[model samples]
Target chain A: MEAIKDKKNLQVVINAGWCKSCGICIDLCPKGALGRDNRDKAVWQYPDKCIRCGLCELRCPDLAITLQEAEEEE
Target chain B: MPVKRYLRQRFFPQLWCAGCGHGQIMASLIRAIEELGLQKNNVVVVSGIGCSSRMPGYLDFHTLHTLHGRALAFATGVKMGRPELNVIVPMGDGDASAIGGNHLIHAARRNINITAIVMNNNIYGMTGGQSSPTTPVAAKSTTAPLGNIDPAFDLVELAKGAGASFVARSTTYHSKEMQNMFVKAINHKGFSFVEVLTQCPTYYGRKNEGVSPTEMMKKFATTTTSIGSPKKKENPELIERGVFVDQERTEYASSYCEMINQMRKQK
Candidate 1:
């Protein structure tokens, strides 16, 4: 459940277990920030390219993708 | 709590087909329930027989998977028996409009406190892709190989005509809007009917345009417009999406209680 932290202080987490690789999120991502992993699961491939619009999180049919604010480091 | 907590964890990687719109609807529904901050134990998810009816099984709320087209009937009983509980019924197109149409209208007429979501995927995906009541004219299905000649039922109009206190329409492609509509529908005091246009890529898509799930979803975005939008005026063919009716009315359960109290007072 560890989230992938990008430079913009946002966490893009994709639950691999539930992802069916439907490609909806990948196809709908306006910035092409999402890409398929070796297992064909969606991954935050280009973290820098994400605009934090949350479209991927909103339209993910599988409920596998999530965007959250990165926790502040002590 | 996270949205995942509202779901039955053991049911992860749900049985729905990949890219099926039911998952999206389920996700939106869970999000709506979470946003409303409703107690999970106090909510009930009732469903009838169909691919869409399987939603209750994955949700963590008190759920009842009932007989075909009888979800509304069972939901009525549940609401009457436990007036305080929030009853939400998710039904398939055929389940709500065909087999259960009577229950649906009666529930609406009674103005019962319940939220009914009609997942209108057009074709019945579960029973080998047969044409349902909402299947459009000239649409191809297993039961309509030469293209269906039957006209589709206008669910929103039907619910409005049945006197539902709240009525709305949203497609799976409009998940954000759908979630908001779900919130409003649940909060509505009387019977609320929300018809969600979903896609059955396996059956409807293959038999018709042979499009993928993503394409079907994209089509939804293009074909639907907000209620009273100028786009609809220009192109009458576009499906209108949004709340068509939202009026306050005396809820059935409360009225029944008041009647019982009045009789007791006379005694």
Candidate 2:
């Protein structure tokens, strides 16, 4: 189990291929971290604002989104 | 500059229980609000009677510490009246699923825009160790001297079935996870319910195992499992304890707002 230490590094990744563009993740994100991109995929715009609440991942209808502790290199 | 931070609850302590999980739950709520950067003035904490329901007295934000079993009813009014503000209801097991069960079910069915955090300690610690609606069967409580004959109500499943848009469950010992779930519940646009399986060690514990609050928390840590992903098959009882449900349904508040907008446009 990977523990999340610094919440700022937390990032939400949406697999565009699997995404149905249902926008459930967008609506469920408490920090307003997600928005629709040009391709209609849920994009992480305000990544810093994310508290890694995991609501997006949990509420994703297609399970297309994943929350990961962003690599330190990033 | 905007206020650096505002105390969501008033500084004074209202809950009297020693090592009660209600205070921790309240603190998690306040931290979640701060993490979301929600203005304290725009957040309202509504509660009902019970040792846990006294949470509103400590919050600095707009609060309504109402009569027993009516927190949800009043919260509905608050959300309907001030749709802009964040409405959060912090309640005890008996206050939420027992006497207040009707309001709770309807609120979920209506998909009202309110976040209800149910602090389920099994027994009603407030009025002594009475068996609450969520008290597990065979659990020893003051009211059930021999043992509880009634089966416990799985609040998460009930809320999900009653039409809650989002439902999650966590424990007081898992503070970080509880905070995360709470943040999600608050941010959700529709009716969101989170069942916090807490410990009433002083009352429930003394009756059951004569253990301290810390020991009871250890039991919670051991007995419960995360919701979506079962930790392991070894403890079937502990499995299914984390974020059980998280999906979007038609939001009652936003849908109503849209309907009003369309009606005005038609006129």
The i-RMS of every model, in angstroms, reads 1.5, 17.6
| Per-candidate local distance difference test | 0.92, 0.77
The candidate that achieves the highest DockQ relative to the unseen native structure: 1
Q: Is the docking of candidate 2 incorrect, acceptable, medium or high quality?
A: incorrect
Each candidate's DockQ: 0.60, 0.02
What count of clashes does model 1 give?
A: 0
Could you estimate the TM-score for every candidate?
A: 0.95, 0.74
Computed on C-alpha atoms, the DockQ of candidate 1 is 0.60
List, residue by residue over B59-108, the lDDT tens digit for candidate 1. Answer: 99999999999999999999989999999999999999999999999999
Superposed model 2: Cα runs more than 4 Å off: A1-74, B1-14, B228-232
